[model samples]
Target chain A: MEEHTGKKNYEVDWNEYLPGVAIDCVIFGYHEKVLKTLILEYKETDFFALPGGFVLKDENLDEAASRVLFERTRLQEISLNQFYTFGSLSRFNPEPMRIVMQKNGLEPTKSHFLLQRFMSTGYYALVDFKEAEPIADFLSDSCQWYDIHDLPSLLWDHEQIIQKALESLRENIDHRAVGLNLLDDEFTMRELRNLYETILGKELNRSGFHRKMVNSGRLNRIGKKNTGKAHRSPYLYRFNT
Target chain B: MEEHTGKKNYEVDWNEYLPGVAIDCVIFGYHEKVLKTLILEYKETDFFALPGGFVLKDENLDEAASRVLFERTRLQEISLNQFYTFGSLSRFNPEPMRIVMQKNGLEPTKSHFLLQRFMSTGYYALVDFKEAEPIADFLSDSCQWYDIHDLPSLLWDHEQIIQKALESLRENIDHRAVGLNLLDDEFTMRELRNLYETILGKELNRSGFHRKMVNSGRLNRIGKKNTGKAHRSPYLYRFNT
Candidate 1:
């Protein structure tokens, strides 16, 4: 707890940040066929939020989002797509955030940057769940993945952020090869379908889905996976790199 | 010129605006089979910019964007999709904006809100070219459409904003029914294909494009369009309701 508080003491050049702009990332991962998001719990309060950071003065919005993602997940070169900019007036409901800051021994009046209205741009990235190592920021107690269907009480408008991110993901599933980011280098066709079903929140017809997927030309028929299950093993495939 | 300057005198509560957040819209229209974007020429300078406005404290970002669009185009109930948020430090680039303001008799020192850094969220809209009526704002001399390929020198990062909007539009054309917004309610398949090619910046094989369009199941055959040209007329179609 002391270490976390001390980490916040490092002076940030406030001028380098745009007063009213921030970046919130919705990092979606597929684990055990369940869609999850990376979240952080504040050290002194029970408030949870999407892993986010303010845009640096010299950085582009996308670059800022990538920096936040890398800082949290320790993964580089992962692509992030901008989906929506959340700028509702009530988005920065400061009561909970103020409480968290007070509990962390920082006065709300002194932290001008935190109290100002923030219009956050939402950037989402799909990453392999097994490869991501979630690390909490200095102000947070723990960083972990939560099932999107059963999320904890989130701070600010993070719940809405997650919902919008999910909507964007579902709408873009076919248009973009997003599943490739969530799956392994090689996976069974069944695994791929399950991943889609999880994100889409609906079951897809097997034969129709298979035919459509094959015709999409985004996948390559790789070698078969030898699973020790009962019947004949399903063929494995990977994204056309 | 007097009327334009008088319009800017309407008292707006600067404190009621979010300190540094703004919205810029790229209103895209297709005319004469050439893609064009709505632009405004500042009254005091030859510089042009996307029709943009600051975010009111009580308004959502989308609402602000919609207001800007409606104020400029005089159209309501049109949907605007957000593509990206431009937050680069140099995005404001005050020199040109300052020049325009001074030329309009606005003292930059007195206009606190205008001089501050703004992180603007970019929203784009596809509109039927014939239906839209572009109007210049208080500080602009004219509001008109310019062919995207032959755009004039624009203010700040507006050129970059338009480029990003075009990129987003091209990528989402197949995924979303963007053509529906840019075309008349009922149009021929050839008109649809031409619209696609204009945005995509390339020609497509006629037969293959027709096959793909038909397979997409987004269009409904309405009737034959009597073009009155010497050749055979083509079938008219409308988007599926």
Candidate 2:
């Protein structure tokens, strides 16, 4: 009975402990035989980060995620999926920020204290670069897409968040094709092949890739793309959606 | 320049104004034609609840979740997918737990005050009931599975958590299956069918379901069930895992 009472006492004490919660975005776009991720450089703070925003009083989680994506990307109809909620209490520090905080003579107390104790919800999206006009909202100086394999030192554990999102995307690739969002309305078969090869990190047989794409019945074959050379033109395809 | 400083001040204040983070579990199991979930009856407390625990200081969020699951059900080796995070300040009681506090004759101080200002990460898993031998658990009553569609009244926004988990499960069904944990190594196709029907809330055509199951190539057909009925015994199957 005493043991049970002690457990209850602990719960009672922890019940009132208030901690901060924030949301981060991991937006991926595929281009140039490389899987790329959109990251932001904070203008005033000089912090390179993912596009993120706080939850509002009247917003649902899905709404909050959508608002963050739409507002930052300036994309009207892109869909953002809530992939993971990172509450490890350690995901807040994206490595480089430690140096920035120290160099700025800002005792890590102000940033570290709240961050190490807080939880962050991670949302990711795939968007067509042609549609997604990157807007430098909030603290951002600019938003740019970097090759996933070669990312600049990011602030906090944002790189880890990107890696996790890519892993999830790879596992669910057969269920839904995400690279459709990274292309224009019409794209060449070569471009599509490059996107898959980049994400899967293996060179797929060209014929086999085309066969699977055609059989998947999710793409509409369009007119050919002329290379303006004597070479055979590659057919263009658009997502059926 | 003054406005920029004011904006910086707002950003600083924003960190201080965020809500606290918490974790919620959507523990699902299969029973009858109704998909069931494990919930707890809180003793000396007004409502029944899902077994939940706070993320510990020294542990990762996943570790904390597994600890909570093991402590409640005594079931280990379960992998939980962290999918959604709910962050509605109104999710907590808009008013204080005034009646409950009054009943317990406790004063509501700021330190002790409870409002629904939580950002809860949702972790969901499937656990075999035979393995889930609840031990040293906090529940006042035996942990049992209640039909998810017809769940008992629960505290906070637990109902929403379960609803969202089920929706995620349905959306991702083609990529993953959940209820194999609840069944034995060998199960009749009928048993599998029943599980799917319950989750999907729709009766599948028997032959079509069987055909698709076989086509998926993820199941191995074993011998027949030794039922003493005149009708042909249904074939047993095991997961290819």
Candidate 3:
């Protein structure tokens, strides 16, 4: 706690961020046939939270979500959608925030902006699982990926945020190529189906799933037909950009 | 102006409402196979806008949207979805707001709350067009449904708001049963398909659309099969509640 509080990076500049509003991200990645999300464990406490940050006065909301995700995961190319804004009187408990401030070596004042109730706008993105290297913020000790079904104790309505994000992601699958970002640039149809199965939390039929994806006109088969399966290797496909 | 500003309803009690946040709704309705949305005409100006309102300090975002919609349409049973949040410096211009205040017989001071920047939460709802009676707010002369394709001059970023709402509505159909609300308690399959076509803004293959809807397991056949197609009436469906 002493080490964390003494760090200069922990200080917040209230004037730079939008007052009474913030952005939180629910970053999804597919791995081991399970849907997972990034979570952060707060320093010097057992509290855990989703990656979140404040929007600057001059910046737009989407840009703020991207910035927050990048700050935590160092991944900038991930596409994000502003799904929903979560503002409820029940989420206004200040205990977790108070602990965060004290751990950062700052004594809370009654007028501190950090203690004010925030109407956080929720944004979400799907990233290639192997690509993101989670980096915790000053207030957090570690950032790591955890299965959506098995999460640690979440802080301040984060469980609800993740639930909303999953629902939005399910709705966004067609218009937004969310599954594409969850896999590498070149992946086999089998791998793609696995990703979808993980995301939707159910198994899909083989030929039906393949036909639906092919008919959607969103997939492009890679490698030449004449190449002949390259020693039994499955045909690779990439989402049409 | 004197007639409007002198009214007590126009006076805002700032302490009771949340600052820096508001809700704007795009209420969708179907008529004559065309998608229509509710629009408001500013009291004394030719400018038009979507029906919108402020959120009370204790009210949740969804509650605020419902309250605002009920206030204008007098329809409380309408179901709503929080699709997106619109926040950008480009949308914060104060001229239109100044005109709105002034038309309501109030002068805009340099530091008036209405003149400040606000990040609006966008919500969309589908309502039975014939059932809803549009009632304008104090600052608006009339609230009426207009064809989405042939909207009047919209104020602020309302045009973009409507576009976003349409896309969200399309995405929301599978999970939300949004088209159900645009119809009465009971409807025939052809009428449902027409609503779907209007909402999607495209013509779908007849058999394929019908098959897909039936297979989705969301629709239930109304009236017994023993009741033959009386006078060539098609089998009706009401979404399974």
Candidate 4:
């Protein structure tokens, strides 16, 4: 069992944080044409969860989210977006929290702040994975990347958080300038297509992809001219460089 | 002063609402080819604000938002989108709230929940102006629709919330099936264009708009075949049926 624990292991200053609220971040990175999400393994427990923390009473919610994101990923530069908030009564199970506390050599108090019902604001960001130095939160043993498609069982509704974050990312992929964080400036057309495929979970026809990208005017073309009719598939994909 | 006041209004059981969190809705409507937003003018005060309410300890956050929306607009079935959560330190001022409480016959308790800091989730929805019978919240004198472009000075950061909501709605105008809420099924092309133009805050070329609408495959031709080339305005608008 890992001896590591946040300040809460001793005593939590309840007034330091806003009650009934927390923040969770779904940190995503793209590399080698595969999309990966950063997750944490809880200390001395089989439980895994998205990196999250509480909002300080004096801090803006967005600032609190950014602090949590920066603390784990160590990437200050980002365009973090708040996608959704989750607050279901079922998410308030105290059993897992008890296990976490006991395993970490801390006694569980019925009135413990961590054991209380909390609604979490879900924030997400796209970052250059290579630049991020992953550091585990005090409650977690380790932080690492897992393919979005393959992940261990997660705690609470974290799986749903990841799905929602991914959905939001895909929805705004065209306007979010995601490539600035995920790709090199001198990347080729094939590399860009692979990035789209990874995010979209489907293969796009090569000719059609080229036509759409060129027509979008977000990408500057060098060398030879390219042209083609997009395939008949009804899905229209747009990109922002 | 109007005599109407909300239930806690008189006695806000802090237990009823999850403290420090609330929900605000920027209800939108399109009629007479003009876009308007629902706003409330507080009773016994010159204060105006969006329709909002606190969440119960047992209720889902979205459910609370929907309840508030229903209480104000009385629209039960809708596609309400949570656009953003506002929680800046500047929004914590208790002066306006004190005025509201005093004017509403509420004793200004130092620890009053309404005087404390609150983070509000902003929600937005489109509706037929005729269908939504505007009812003022307990604290307000009248619930009325004001053209978004020409609105009275608003309270708190609600102006920002409305701007953000309208922006989000416009961003998704093409993708969201907004026609269902704002327009009749058998609407004419000119009417549909007017609706889009109203939300977009700009005029669209008639022939170009028709060609693009038809090409997007969201609309079916009524009788004689209509044809035209979309002007090269560089905007690629899509629509959902």
Candidate 5:
């Protein structure tokens, strides 16, 4: 199979792809106190989707997800958590997928593996928004970050996948120390609280949240934020390595 | 394909099974302060494994897992959570699987779909130990429960599957009210702590644990447990319904 770009053509051997397993990644990034996810738009179409790829027969599923993440974000060794596996027969809608294949200059019916029902494992990673440079693959028009609340209509079960990933993220926020990955190395308590509020989609009590954070032993007081106003400056903290 | 037993032979059509996706259930039960998992032993062999089954083309994977759980336990509507999917290329050990097939009167090479690699989704359900009647399917000689700490050698990455399930269980124990399913309707504080300790495989600070549990707002103090001694009586609690 060849990915037809305007200027270049990239070849992918269909036979080398695994028959029934695929990986879709929900890459969560925090920007401007809002939680966002990286998504790809199909060229010349309104379709948006999670960055996904088929596993190679020789690779593990986690490795396949890592490869997809690295290709899209140009980052490596980012911890990816496998949250759920979506195996419903209706996960793949034939109409939109066919349109996508046709637009990419491929015949969907001939791609038997792609046409058949397959299971997709959802993996999520929290990344610093500014650190990731989203690059679209040849099959997509562009890769962009969308705020979780204002997402476009996604194709297939990508919206549900994002929801599940978000649920997993919220369920694990307090226990997993994910702020280390989503926030800067040093940040004010307000930034951390905002990150949690954004992901959890709720307003947490300020004093109680601060007390819980301080008692968790996962953070260390590093310095004070140098706000222009002296009386309003807050202590900055970092995740204890 | 046929299941050969001492009394009768059962036939199954290989074509009816889903091609590449399967479900394995790690059914966990608690008894005598020890956490145990239900496993099956194949007839005329030492191979033990988690109770598992293949999905049907018309059924969802979760439905397939539920069916497998119901068949093994003679119970239905047991809530099972999908924990992880195992898709490593080496997950299926060919030698052992071939022996299992041959012993079951299946020509492995002739069963192309069975011989080819497949992916399995792992699910776990917590059940009351005494409430479950372990029944072996035609493929196995007997079904039994084994203590998680003293597990027998399992077949084909099942040990890893159980380990992953245990990890997931431990991670969710504090957050989700899973004790509602694992414990009796009413219990003492010590019993609740014991259940938590058994699932977590560690001892927790008694007063701190109790305080956290009480503050979580998921429990209700129904009454006091009269242990036949004045000093030994403890508060009986139930999960807030």
Candidate 6:
């Protein structure tokens, strides 16, 4: 889309000799004890994929991931990070990609220049689904969140990509504060507990969970909500930091 | 090293593509509370690097890392897992690389065919110093462990590679047993404490540390270490798993 200057930059020429690498994003969101991952359905094949876009030549890996998350998901200025880079040479199989590319009247062998040697870095964003709307871009038909356990088969190494992202999320729980990314501005403590239980795949003891949750010092109790079915009013707490 | 002619055969033209990507090992060893990393000094320049060799075409990323670790550092059959992949388009700079190639009487412009690509995944192994013997390879003039805290400037993005490996190590400490990777078959409880202190960059409370450690049931007390100057013999323990 842009032109190179009159003088050829050897660096540019060097890049032309190499295959391009890109980044993909797997955004996870939680609501009401259900863990879901944001995915896009491509127009023709109805094939589902994590909402992803290519990395720009000038962007850093981390920035590229954020850019894609914002552009495709309509969720801007959210925190995202690089978790892994999938680089198995077999990832570029034309047989699987041929179905999708050929539908657009493109030759898999000639038009897919970046496929053979390309590597993709996977990044993940933990965001609230209530704040996100799927923006169908060039290749997508619709965007939606699928339950982690009930995901449709994905293209390329996407299944493995989601698996790795979940693993990274589980491992990072102690150091990273994920609740803020997935929760609403104000929510009941039970809502927060349900979110953790779903992501961790286990039930937490109410008393013990409350103790640890308070000790983390990130919660601010605002008010209580009287759900008519409950004996006591459930307190609402917002993430302070 | 082996051809793929099995039931799940994937047919592709090998010659049209660049050579398969490889992994490099940077094994770190600790002794006397000082961290050390294995390095191989190359010819024609004062620059040095971690003792690393090529990954075989047919091997998995982890296997390739272990192979390089064993073949070059003489740390045989040790496990080394992939931590990060470094593959920026400009990662393989041809400018200074050309000089190095020329110094070795090779035409850099022609010889370095994979100048812009050649993505290399970096893996790290943590081993006890007593088990390793660094050997000189084709490009290596010497092999030895340099103190990690006082490392000389490294080639490429090797510094960032080391940082990522260490961060991964820290994240895995709670769920995975990393102490076993750096300890001998048997060790004293004090020695284990020292190792944690060095890695965590903090001094732990003796009673608190002992309580948490013993409760974990991962250590088996063998006997006692007879310190001649000490009033009481210190207990010695071995990792149970």
Listed per model, the TM-scores of chain A against the true chain A are 0.92, 0.74, 0.89, 0.87, 0.93, 0.84
The estimated TM-scores of all candidates read 0.84, 0.73, 0.88, 0.88, 0.90, 0.83
Specify the highest-DockQ model's number: 1
After superposition, the stretches of candidate 4 with alpha carbons farther than 4 Å from their true spots are: A1-12, A221-241, B1-8, B220-241
Report the Cα lDDT for residue A79, model 5: 95
| TM-score ranking of the models | 5, 3, 4, 1, 6, 2
* Candidate 4 per-residue C-alpha lDDT over A1-241 given as tens digits, one digit per residue, 9 for 90 to 100: 0111255445556668888889999999999978999999989899999988888888899988888888887788588889988877778787898898888776789988888888889999988989988888767799999999999999999999999999998888776468777887556678888999999999999989989888888876543322353353223333344
Between the candidate structures 3 and 6, which one is better when assessed by TM-score? 3
- Where does the lowest 10-residue lDDT sum fall in candidate 5 chain B? B1-10
lDDT of 2 at B14: 22
lDDT of 6 by residue, A80-169 (tens): 766877766556655655666565455567645534445677888888878888676455567788999999999878999999998888
* TM-score between model 3 and native: 0.88
Q: Rank the candidates by DockQ, best first.
A: 1, 3, 5, 4, 2, 6
Scoring each candidate complex against the real one, what DockQ results? 0.66, 0.36, 0.64, 0.57, 0.64, 0.25
Would you list the clashing residue pairs of candidate 5? none
Whole-model Cα lDDT of every candidate shown, in order: 0.83, 0.67, 0.82, 0.81, 0.83, 0.68
lDDT of 4 at A80: 89
1 against 2, candidate with superior lDDT = 1
Candidate 4 chain A worst ten-residue window by lDDT: A232-241
Per-residue CA lDDT of model 1 for A114-167, tens digit only, reads 777788889899988888999988778888999999899998899999999999
lDDT of 3: 0.82
lDDT of 6 at A167: 88
Q: Which stretches of candidate 6 lie over 4 Å from their true place?
A: A1-20, A53-56, A89-92, A114-118, A174-177, A225-231, B1-24, B51-59, B87-95, B117-120, B174-177, B226-231
- Report the lDDT tens digits of candidate 6 across residue range B1-241: 1122211112323332335254667787888787778876666777666655443344444555666777666667666666776655555555654655556555556544423345567877888788788776554467778887888887776777777777776656554346777777677777878877777767999889898889998889987777774658888888776
Q: Which candidate is the best by TM-score?
A: 5
